[model samples]
Target: MRTQVVIVGAGPSGLLLGQLLHKAGVDAVILERQSPDYVLGRIRAGVLEQVTLDVLAQAGVDQRMNKEGLVHTGFDLLFKGERHRIDLSGLTGGQKVMVYGQTEVTRDLMDARQAAGLTTIYEADDVQIHDFDSDHPSVSYSKNGKTQTISCDFIAGCDGFHGVCRASVPRKSIQEFEKVYPFGWLGVLSDTPPVHEELIYANSPRGFALCSQRSLTRSRYYLQVPLTDKVEQWSDDAFWGELRNRLDPEARENLVTGTSIEKSIAPLRSFVTEPMRFGTLFLAGDAAHIVPPTGAKGLNLAATDVKYLSDALIEACVEKSHAGIDHYSTRCLARIWRAERFSWWFTSLMHRFPDQGEIGQKFQEAELDYLIHSEAGSRTVAENYVGLPLNFGE
Candidate 1:
């Protein structure tokens, strides 16, 4: 098999990159290690930044999103029973986030790709990328116990943090920066309706709890806990009790309790690899960096990466110059770091650390109190939440 580009992963980044390249008349092939059903059913990110939504719309993939996604102008910060709303539109000048699950976005993009007659190999195994520096880079994979190789002009490593694509690059050329938080998020999805109209970040003596809605019929929530804690130890009763203690007490009565539809724990971390590109293989999304979930920037950052990557590849193929690809690393890093900093700031503010002493805890509470009470602090939250525009030229 042969193509202009080979995308390794069917997640948001790879799928969107394929769609964008297809629109520009570039031939591309996508390979995924997971089954199509599993890829579409995985529950992940729910918030879409304004810039992400705009990109989807421009790409003609927002038909279902605009109809199914829930829009919000603001979110609430709950501290000491006091609720403070950060008006995103007011601070960001007409920007708001849309609540749409990452699964739905993947479904939409995959459907679009299929309808356009694009080739996407799911359940592909043993996928290996080779000769990224050569004029003919190739991706070899096995499907149904049959091995095959697809050659391409460029290889896009969007296979995520654990995938082999990133590690394929020699270690001497890579510089990694990482910070693992002491706390992890216990995320759950339930059939119960949301207790509030907007998402709420609650600060309590117990810990941090985020109240968010996936849809009118489903609610998504998270609790900050020790990274070492196991989900099995948190029974349904214990989970609800913890949620009640962390969220607004008065709203507890209104918080509907339901059987958990899905539950999982994710460790919190911030990571970035300097220079996101190496020769003809360009890394995007989780393959390049990771952000703590506090600011909901992971998916948005991935989308931003594909946006710039698609443009660069199109220019390289059309103009016959490696100029765009040559600068891919430096250009994507600027926006990547901005988002990295924002996620770090939000995570630091919201999650309590076990190592934090009494003085540190007191200072954290004071900061939360001020953020909830001061307009300036609220605006800062709003701006970061809505997302800062990507600096593609960098």
Candidate 2:
């Protein structure tokens, strides 16, 4: 097979990139190690920054999202038994987030890609990239007991953190920075209506909890837990019981409990690699960076990364301009670091670190008190939550 670009991983990042490139008259092939059903089965974050929505629109895959996704202009910050609304729209001049599940977004992209007749090989085994350091790069994978190779002008590594693309790089050629939190989030998904009209980030004596949603009737909630905890340790009744204990009285009273459709524990971490470009190979999304879900920047960051990457590839392929591709790393890293900082800051503010002790708790309370009461502090949180502009500092 031959193409202008070979995208590794059929996840949102790769799918979105392929869609964008195809719309721009560039030919690309996508390879995924898992089936489409397996990809959609992975429950992930649902918050959509405006930038992500725009990119989905650019990819021509926002019909379902615009129709079914819930739009929220604000969310509550519960602290010291008080619920304070951070007016995201009011603070950010009408910018808002869409509560659309990541799975839905991937589905839309997949549907669009299928309708457009793009090439995507799923369940591709032992995918490998060859000669990415030179001008001509190619990808190879095994399928149906036969190996096939795709010769391409460039390779896109959107496979993810544990993916082969990143693993293929020599350790000395790349620098990795990571911080693993001591606690994890125990999340539950149910068909119950949300307790509040908007999402709530609550900090209590017990721990931190988040009341989020996928739609008006489908709610997703989370609670801070020790890393040693397991899903089997908590039942539906216990989960609801513990969640109620963390919320303010009003929220607790309004909360609706039901059997969880899905439950899991996910650890928080901030990870980033420098210079996303490696010779003829470009890395985007989780392959290059990962942020804690606190700031809701994971998918949004990936969208922006794809936007930058697709534009760069289009410029190089169609316009015969190498500028965008050349500067892709510097441009993306700037925004990536900013998001990493925000995610780290937000996680630190909301989570109760086991090592922080009483002093840390006092400091968090003090900051939360100031943040909600002060307009400037409130806007800071609101703007970051809504996502910064793509050309943030530039």
Models, CA RMSD each: 1.4, 0.7
lDDT of 1 by residue, 62-129 (tens): 99999999999999888767677888888778889999999999989999999999999999999999
**Candidate 2 lDDT by residue in tens digits, 246-323:** 999999999999999999999889999987888999999999998999968999999999999999999999999999
* Inter-residue clash pairs, candidate 1: none
Q: Candidate 2's C-alpha lDDT?
A: 0.94
- Computed on alpha carbons, the lDDT of every model, listed in order, comes to 0.88, 0.94
In the predicted model 2, the residue pairs found to clash are: none
Worst 10 residues of 1 by lDDT: 385-394
For the record, the alpha-carbon RMSD of candidate 1 to the native fold, in angstroms, is 1.4
Error of 2 at 118 (Å): 0.9
TM-score for all models, in order of appearance:
0.97, 0.99
Candidate 2: misplaced stretches above 4 Å? none
Tell me the TM-score of model 1. Answer: 0.97
Off by over 4 Å in 1: 392-394
User: What lDDT score is found at residue 184 in candidate 1?
Assistant: 90
